[model samples]
Target: MSGGLIGLSGLIILFVLLIIRIPVAFAMFAVGFAGIWVLRDLNSAMSLLASESFTIASSAELVVVPLFILMGNVASVTGMSARLYDAAYAIVGQIRGGLALATVLGCAGFAALSGSSVASALTMGKVSMDQMNRFDYDNRLSTGVVAAGGTLGILIPPSTGFVIYAILTQQSIGRLFLAGILPGLLLLSMFMLTVVLLCWLMPGFGPRGPKSTMREKGRKMAGALPVLLVVILTIGGIYGGLFSPVEASAVGAGLVILIGVLEGRLGFARFWEAAKSSIVTSATVMLILISAHLINPFLALTHIPTLIGEYLSALDVAPMVVLGLILLTYLVLGCFLEGFAMLVLTMPIFFPVITQLGMDPIWFGVLVVLTLEMGLISPPVGVNVFVVKSVATDVPLGRIFAGVMPFWIAMLVTLAILVAFPQIALILPNTMIE
Candidate 1:
């Protein structure tokens, strides 16, 4: 068999492994190592595996992953996320569908620090679900909004999704991060609008929440101010060229830890728990990245990316048409694969086609990350939906999925808008300070 076909078979086997409930990192690692051994030699495979693991583990820029994760964990444990949610609820809870809007806003706020849909969903779900239920909101909308809103974590800055895309594509992490901001805010706005439309069409989906006086609202807002400042400073510092992405992540994580500790919100036990969670999450990401490095080289040895890119290049269709198809593939894959797995597996093939088509890597990265966000709430394997379900145990899985449908459509709309006007993502990246 040709090396390409052998590579193809290895990929199929990898998916089969994944289907059998093997961990993604292990599945990729096993397939990639075996592919190298078969296509090259055992010595070459061993060398690549060892070198790649060390490279991934030792890379300084990758420190952003653990630091950002630490930020999220600290925020979750210290009640910073709860305060953010309470602030949004105070500001928006009184209007029809206001609680849902607050949920989206809260999710957005937490996304800035957390950079994780699961964390965002878990934190926001715990904070907002009971309040929505108390307001007699529909279970579907309440859970759905949390699931959908949590997806903002991947679209916003400090996003692990953006970080992964940057590392895979060799794009600038800061520029990729900048690229996500406008698009993220746009998606956040669209989600809020979706809630408005739903409430207008069916008032029962999200009932009006109790009103908050200005004094009460001020208190909630005041409570969130410290953490909010951390978001502003970390993101702004990145934007203004004051800090590298890794440095920004460190500053953000440090600020959260300091703020939490000083306020007695993160006591010794909680602090240790947050740090442990961050380490575990970071280790998992490092493993996935290392496996990706191994698999990418094996695929290179097979010339599969070249084979596919050449075929796509010879096509007569406009590049945008091809881009649309690539995104459509992502949308379909969203129902099955986790975002990181899809990114690490497909970027070697698709990103080459992208550059060959004369597309901006930063623009494509934003688009790809946005597509990953959609997967977080897509059914059957909507990771964020399931995360929400874990916290909202009384809400049916089907109901959570149903609730997220409108927001999913909103994501589609946002993607379409960005595709039509690439500037939405590129403007900030293009104008970046450094």
Candidate 2:
């Protein structure tokens, strides 16, 4: 059989494995290893597997994964996330649909710290859901807000999605991180506007919340200062050349831990638990990345990327048209695949085509990550929706999906805006990073 045929078969089997509920790491590993063995030799496959695993395991750049995760975990355990939510609430909770707006803001804030959609959704859901419910907010609006807001985790700085995309495409992590800033804030604003519109159209969807006194708002903001400062220092440090991404991760984690200790919010036992959770999450990411490395080589050996690139290049359509088609493909796949899996599985095939068209990889990275966020709320495999459902068990799964639809449309608008004006993603990376 031809190499293409073998690669095609491997992908089919990999999809089958995923459909049957095999873990993503194992599925990719199995398909990649088998494909290599068929095209080359068992020894080659084995050596590649061993070397890739070790390389990914020992990667210095990836150290940010665990450290950043630890910062988020520690923040969650030590009540920093709660305080951040309180601050947002004090500032906006009095307006109509303000609590929902605050949830989105909180999710954005936590996204900066955690950089995981699931973590952002889970943490913000716990922190904001009850508060929204107490204000008699519609479950659909409340659940939808959390689910959609959590997706900001992947688009904001320190995003694992960007890290994986950068590693796969050989782009700069700092540049990708910088590229995400404006777009992330844009999406956050879009979500807030969606909330305002929803409440305007349906007055009962989210009632007006009680206003906070200026002193109360000031006090709440004061309480949230530590988290806000950590967010600023770590992300600002990266943009200002004060620290590399790795060093920023370490600094953020250390600051959060120190603050927790000083406030008597995190004892040794709680810190240990947070660390353990971070290790587990980091391990999962590392495995996916290693498996992705294996799969990239396997696909390369099959010449699949070359073939796809040729096919795309031969098209009579404009580059932007081709780009739109590729993004549409991501949106369709997002319904079925986890964001990172989609990135690893498609980037090798798509990145070559994108570069061939002379498109900017950093901008493409931001667009891809943003599409992945939409998937988090898309039905069937909407991971963030399920995450919100877990937090609000009394709310039916369907309602959460329904709630997220408008926000999903809002995301579509944000995606369109980004597409129309690529500068939203490229400006910071271009002007600030050099």
Summed backbone clashes in each candidate are 0, 0
Clashing pairs in 1: none
State in Å the error of residue 387, model 2. Answer: 0.7
| Model 2 lDDT tens row, 70-120 | 999999999999998999999999999999989999999999999999999
Lowest summed lDDT across 10 adjacent residues in model 1 is found at 425-434
CA lDDT of 24 in candidate 2?
Answer: 94
**Cα-based lDDT for every prediction:** 0.91, 0.93
Best by lDDT: 2
Report the CA-based lDDT of candidate 2 relative to the real structure.
Answer: 0.93
Clashes of 2: 0
